[model samples]
Target: MTNLNASHASHRNFILTGIPGTPDKNPWLAFPLGFLYTLTLLGIGTILAVIKVEPSLHEPMYYFLSILALTDVSLSMSTLPSMLSIYWFNAPEIAFDACIMQMFFIHVFGIVESGVLVSMAFDRFVAIRNPLHYVSILNHDVIRKIGIAILTRAVCVVFPVPFLIKCLPFCHSNVLSHSYCLHQNMMRLACASTRVNSLYGLIVVIFTLGLDVLLTLLSYVLTLKTVLGIVSRGERLKTLSTCLSHMSAVLLFYVPFMGASMIHRFWEHLSPVVNMVMADIYLLLLPVLNSIVYSVKTKQI
Candidate 1:
């Protein structure tokens, strides 16, 4: 047998650890996670339904909101099934292919979610900056193109990850850090040199998520600057109020993910349990929190 094929044959499966240090308590862990999942689905689902049914919401801003809802749903579903299986059924064993597939979806959807946030920031900018041209600039066709572009960019950026990881032979310990498959965590399981994988992952993240963050910030800055042009203080406050929900989404979406990334990078001394909890927070908090924020803060919703 060839060396590469032989190595591949040896490591076809992996184990997902739901949480560290409490093997016997795995089933109980399922309850809280399942509860959170239910709430997220309902909350985001309601937002989507409201947007779809309300004829008045057939505009650029709400269309982007719908895309955000869909992104959140995608993010939650990408990880929830395996996570539940791990904790509830003790089914932690996953084939290599399956693990890679899950990792691909999680990261791609995550990137798409970030891209959507950036697009919304741009929407806010245009609405506030060029109010007269808002309708004309961001018509239905433009919104559709923005959504497609976000998804396409996410797909193109993340499409290489599975293939990159799959090319590497994972003959080492096949245990993952959490219930879900994350690119960084999965890369650790490979026995081969993962320098290429790590470098590429870092580059993709920096270019996609990192770039999106910077641009989103620029959009908000410009938006705030434009809002300042309104003469009356009350008018300025009212104009900025329209952006509160989006600002909340941007905060909820980026903060935890950035925290998790930092933890992964600099603080390896922390317990695996801490990392696992942070991963859950990063994945669980964004969608659920964004749903509530938009539902409450958005007047039309």
Candidate 2:
């Protein structure tokens, strides 16, 4: 039985390789990506440091913002090293286990980001919609519970992705079209039937990303309505201003992601380079932009 399992796993191995002779393609692209990666780290690090050092920011909102920054940093780290290595040393071949590890963390941080955003929305809702109850509702214990809830949701939603990938038979093509082992791209290399993998992927999309977006929108909708109800213009503006950072960050992250996913899924004939560029935009650029959007707009961050 053990030999049988090893055979099955061997058949499932995907042979990844770097781009031929010219291992490194565009050296120029690396400069910008490297800069952006630095900026992302710096921005997120600043936010986290501030949240930790400043006692004034011990509230639920700042806590969630710190988590958001941390998640962005983690997400960027998961892919940037491989991307940079490809650009610098031309080491494009990732081992099967390493590839799977990258995919796992990518999904993990992606889901965690979604959860953080949702929790931020909820925090804003309580602060704006129920100010009087905010203290009672989001105290220290409550914040801990919320943190656990977010982590739990992220873990539960993304757990199946790596497991499903492990179970799939990949006896066919080994080369992944993209730089990373994206779920869909990996599925395409499967020798066995991919129907199960595809269906599970769809379920993850619907529950993890889809539900998070829906909840975020619902929270903002209610928040907007509450803001409008305020009679004092000064108070209303202040409330909306507080939410601007998070709202902008959400748009920056989700819009391009949805667009890229739609293009990849429906418009299969799109250029592979185009898809790679889009992935970079969604994964790296978006996180860097989120830091800027939050810090510049919400100076408190």
Candidate 3:
């Protein structure tokens, strides 16, 4: 009876934590976080506007960049509210349904961003491997279709997650590890059997983000092979230069992401603060860094 009552209360209500060990530091932390988030929006917005206005920037590469920018904004926005509420106002209470929706958006936008990076890799590959046929191959229609396919795949894969989470009875403590809800965090609190949720979550990450990483690596390998065949040292160097920004963006995203994931799975002994910091870096800092690298490095941008 006690367990059932705890489950009932926890299922309907939850409290978000801001850096498990430092409540006093949350307000101070909010400043840097808020500043970086604002810069992410401003920088990405400028990039999107520039791409839209410039007729010369309407190619496949720029289009993929635009999609990525939008996804980054969305990905950041999903956590902005809960994070700010916890840091500035000390308001950590989030309803169950709202939490689930937030998690869904975060995963969707994140997966979409991964897909966009893969697309960008392919764009670079095609541009370098067959410069002449690039325009014809990645035409307007093709770009549109790629965007649709990416979104559809994300939506389809994540659609069942909410249902899976909803069925679980959260009988454990309602205090979350981070200021925002995460699928993994939520699943861990469930008192009932979570085999299905765990299995499905693993499957989703493996097939979506994992597959994206593999595809991006393959695209780069093929691109490198093609670049090596180039006889002119100057031409090869110039071609590789075009890929520098994209490579930086990928590292900015995947490094922190992989770090956070590893900490969650293998290093549970580590401080909760490590996971919180890493999550912020992955979700918040990555977009700001990506905007800076692309804007400063890409001459056309």
Candidate 4:
């Protein structure tokens, strides 16, 4: 009887508070949030459309750029509806299944975006290293294959997350801290033993995001080495300049990523109010900043 009742409560609805902390008095903040959503959509959507029709922009770099834009859109869109529901309409109640589904999409696409960025770094390395054969090496077929591989990898890696979440009995407070479902935040809400959840979560981050970041850095290092060997200073400058936008994108994404990780680990030490504020910025700031960065830095955009 006790176990059955526990299992029933585990499946009960979960509440989503705006950002994971106490409510803010400034309802006016929604105006800027709405602007961010619009700007990100317009900027990235324009780039995606332009890349589709322009043959000159159909090469690997822009192909990767399109993927990056698409990934950004996916990341933003995953949490967008729920966020708008909470902020614009003042709705907060989220069913357990809905929360899990949302969590799956967010982490899966988040991993895909990281993978895409790493692939973009490799694209840069190839263009810089073998300018003559860049097209031959990374043709349309190859880029398509790379995109498929990224999606496949993300799906397989994140496939176990929801199952892992389901295996645990969430008998405690069902209220989540953020407007959207996050794997780590949900894990904390599980009343059962979370050793599996915590350990697997750590493993996924280290193997997926950590490995992707390391390889991306390595690609840049090799590209830098190749560029430095060029005798002409202008040539070196031009070659390195191609990477400026990508570097900006990486920083914008990674800083918030690392901040969220640090906050997750040291959360007890910090003030409760700051957690919600930081989570709000971490989730929403990247796409807007990325759109602006690419538009200003990339000539074609």
TM-score against truth, every candidate: 0.95, 0.89, 0.96, 0.94
Q: Candidate 1 versus the native: TM-score?
A: 0.95
Per-residue alpha-carbon lDDT of candidate 2 for residues 1-301, written as tens digits (9 for 90 to 100): 9876655554434443333333445555577778989999988888788889988877888888887888889899998767766666566677777778788888788878888888899899999988988878988888888778877877776677777877777655577876666778777877688788778878888988899999999999999999999999999998899988988888877877787788778987877666766777888887788878877887665
Q: Candidate 3 residues 177-248, lDDT tens each?
A: 888889989988888888998899889889999999999999999999999999999999999999999999
Badly placed stretches (over 4 Å) of model 2 are 1-24
Candidate 4: tens digits of C-alpha lDDT, residues 49-109: 8888887887999989888888888888888877877777777788878888999999888
lDDT of 1 at 278: 81
For candidate 1, write residues 1-301 as lDDT tens digits: 6986775654788888876778888899788888888999999889888888999988789989999999998999999879877988889998888888999999999999999999999999998888899889999888888888989999998998888887887776888888888999988877778899889988998999999999999998898888888899999999999999999998888888888898888998999988877888778877888899999999989
| Candidate 4 residue-wise lDDT at 149 | 97
Q: Any runs in candidate 3 off by more than 4 Å, and if so which? A: 1-10
Write the candidate numbers in order of decreasing lDDT.
3, 1, 4, 2
Clashing residue pairs in candidate 2 (N, C-alpha, C atoms within 3 angstroms):
none
The C-alpha stretches of model 4 lying farther than 4 A from their native spots are 1-8, 19-27
Residue 6, model 2: lDDT of 57
